[model samples]
Target: MTPDSLSRRQLLTLTGSAAAAAALASLSLTGCSDRYKLRCQHQRTGEVYRELNIEIGSVITHSWIHSIELSRWTDIYRFDGETLMLTSTEFEAYGAGMPLDEGDVSVQDGQVVIENIDREFEAIRWIHSHRVDYRIGVDGDESLIDTDALPDLEPLELRPK
Candidate 1:
């Protein structure tokens, strides 16, 4: 065959290769569009720290010490597949910045707790500090993130990916 033309077998092989490539491209572009994940990153510098595959109705909790009260406090979050919701907060003791005299109040696990806040947040940000002892918990597994290693200027954030 001439250089500009192909034999019958060569033409068929080339056509098959092109068709296979097209199918792979389409599958890659359309596959896993509904997959959900939780992305954690630095708010100021936009440095990603971690990405955890999550599902609907997942729970994420942040436990830290109150700067003023010097007592431990925990903020609970729930994933609705599209966004994160601040469901409630637990306090070892009622202190500054807490609703002591009003709103829903309850007790759980021998600690003073509140429930049913029902607030929706697009993302959560916190400036990590060595003193406050920031801890993030996904489901029942803790120690997924380390706050002390991150710098102060880069505040940590949690949002949907």
Candidate 2:
């Protein structure tokens, strides 16, 4: 092959290698968990939750609601899987501990049915102002919830540290 052709091939190979290395490095640093940026605001009090990364786990409420785990930079909370069924703004508001009435944030034919967005926005603001850290699992219990009590939500395959 000509020197020009060989040089071009080498450059292409080097570029490809660099890109692959960068991608791998980023993946290793970030991990496979789902990342979220949830902002909660309650009135003047507002908190921005950044870089929330959570692994797959079951979050069960009293009525067997399956909530997906969420995190702030420091604290963690869980939202019902149905919550994702809403819009991004709605999700953020809910993450902030705003009230979600059936008509405001529920799904109808797979679409977000939010009418009074202002109310939700206010609620989010209120939550952030309150300085409430989102929490996961049973109230006042660090132990894994009994599998029998939660027929829908399963126990953590791995024990909590």
Candidate 3:
């Protein structure tokens, strides 16, 4: 073949390879973005939880107060792969004019067991609380749970300073 024709063919081949590489890189990035949008939901209560931007072996605490004198709740979560373990603590400052408090509000060290994980990133969690058995449903999605809309509960540290 002529030298000019050979050069033209080589250029076309290189250009095609570069385009493929770019498309692959974009797909890889898009996959990561999708993972970041994962969420967890409680089937019974319809309570949805936004996955905190936490790394493995890391713990994050989210607290809210509902008239500190009346009630308050704190949730601590640890994430590992498709599994997320959560420790939820709720406190009632006053009960029927009597001091009645329950549940461990302190940070506990350990891993919570995951019951199930589905193709849609929906996870079923089994929690033993106050001697009662409970199942929590967790699902992933693009939209995150809006804590701002919750009534009577104000996030302790998420507010602007």
Candidate 4:
């Protein structure tokens, strides 16, 4: 055909290149193409984990009834695709193993609320208890862990997936 007209192979290549460029532009505009899922797993074995959809500002909370205090304790985390930020915490009562030196403390619904902690952690680990309630929550949706069924004192963690 004419010198200005693209051959079949050249046309196909151009179409593929344009499609790839559009896909990349879409990802750049949406601004979270590399988002990670919040994952919970058995720490030692690196198994038996669950992954939950997480956005840049997604909130993850882990709460449990403290065995010694027999009261509720909750930790609030924010996921940023690469790390988890400990944003706040709530303790029902002061007792063993509780933070007493933290700043920005207040009382919300009778629980001691500590905000603006703003600490980053690669993974958060905890022990599974047979005698207390344990749960993992994301954006108000919660899943209760069968802590009693897990091996006594089995370790578990939440990290970027």
Model 2 clash pairs are: 41-124, 41-125, 42-125, 42-126, 42-127, 43-125, 43-126, 45-129
Report the number of clashing residue pairs per model: 0, 8, 3, 0
Per-residue alpha-carbon lDDT of candidate 1 for residues 1-161, written as tens digits (9 for 90 to 100)? 43124434564476676764554455448643336777788886777888877767889998888878777788888999678888888887775667765447888875677877778888888877777788888886777767666666457788887
Candidate no. 2 TM-score: 0.22
Candidate 1 structure, TM-score to reference: 0.72
Question: Candidate 2: deviation at residue 138, Å?
Answer: 14
Error of 2 at 131 (Å): 18
Kindly indicate the candidate among 2 and 4 with the higher TM-score: 4
Task: Score candidate 1 by lDDT.
Answer: 0.74
Worst 10 residues of 2 by lDDT: 120-129
lDDT per residue (tens digit) for residues 1-161 in model 2: 42222333464475586765665455557652243222221223222222133232422122122134332221122333212111222232234444455344565443333443321111111111112233223323333333233222121221111
- TM-score for each model: 0.72, 0.22, 0.29, 0.73
Candidate 3 — what's its lDDT? 0.36
User: What TM-score would you give candidate 4 relative to the actual structure?
Assistant: 0.73
- For model 3, residues 21-124, the per-residue Cα lDDT tens digits are 66546655765334332333444464544443433434333444443343343444444444534544334443344322433333233322222221221233
Give each model's whole-structure lDDT: 0.74, 0.30, 0.36, 0.74
Q: Backbone clash tally for model 1?
A: 0
